[model samples]
Target chain A: MKFNVKIEVMLKPGHSDPEGETTARALRELNYPIESVSVSKVYMVVLEAGSKAEAEKMADGMCRRLLANPTKDDYRFEIRETR
Target chain B: MKFNVKIEVMLKPGHSDPEGETTARALRELNYPIESVSVSKVYMVVLEAGSKAEAEKMADGMCRRLLANPTKDDYRFEIRETR
Candidate 1:
């Protein structure tokens, strides 16, 4: 079966987000009434797997091994069968 | 009112995604069955806006002006009132 997977990787709270901070500052300068901003990476993967369970497992492995940094990042993913 | 906005920026079809290609290669080397991979940027913005419409408008402007490249990228955002 083929599956479509979406993974969101984010910095853990308490970790400083310089990019977010910089963007927020720029937004403020541009007069947008923004309180704060945070940024994350989202991965869209299309892959072949035996089942939904298998797809999720593979995505989780990908996140742990390469997509996210354990100490500072947290990751979540969703898997759906492709039509 | 305060709104929480989530924006996703992605490369349009036909545009090259080097990062995605590199990651896909790494995944394949790791022996995960994969057809293709694409990556996007997700921005989480917390801001004060007069209404949801205003929030969305502001986010759209942000995307057009700074967050997304007009030629090769597309963006979408969702705004929700924060409790």
Candidate 2:
């Protein structure tokens, strides 16, 4: 079976987001009336697995091991069976 | 009023996703049985706007002008009123 996995990884609260801050400043300069900005990475993975549960498990493991930094990032994911 | 905007930016269908491909290769090397991978950028913006519609409009404009490359990337956003 094959599964499609979507994972979102973002910096934990209180972590400094320089890129986001810069973007917010730029928006303000453009007169966008923005208060703040936060950025995240979304990963879409298509993989072969025994089942949706197995796919989710593998994706979660991938997040913990490589996709997210435990000290500063948080991650979440959803898995669906695919053709 | 304040609005929370979530924007997702991704490469168009025909564009090559080098980062995603590299990540997928790494996962395969780790024995994850992955077929392919795609990556996107998600922006969480907290801003003040006259209304949700106005917020959405501003966010859409932002995506078009700066956040996404019109030729190779596509973007979508949702806006919600925030306290």
Which one is best on DockQ? 2
Q: Return the clash pairs for model 1, or none.
A: none
> Which window of ten consecutive residues has the lowest lDDT sum in model 2 chain B?
B48-57
Largest TM-score belongs to which candidate?
Answer: 1
True contacts kept of each: 0.91, 0.93
Provide the RMSD of all predictions against the true structure, rounded to 1 decimal.
Answer: 0.7, 0.8
Q: What is the lDDT of residue A76 in candidate 2?
A: 97
What DockQ results for candidate 1?
Answer: 0.91
Backbone atom clashes (below 3 Å) for every candidate: 0, 0
Stretches > 4 Å off in candidate 1: none
Sorted into a CAPRI-style docking class, model 2 comes out as: high
| Docking class of predicted structure 1 | high
lDDT of 1 by residue, B6-46 (tens): 99999999999999999999999999997999999998999
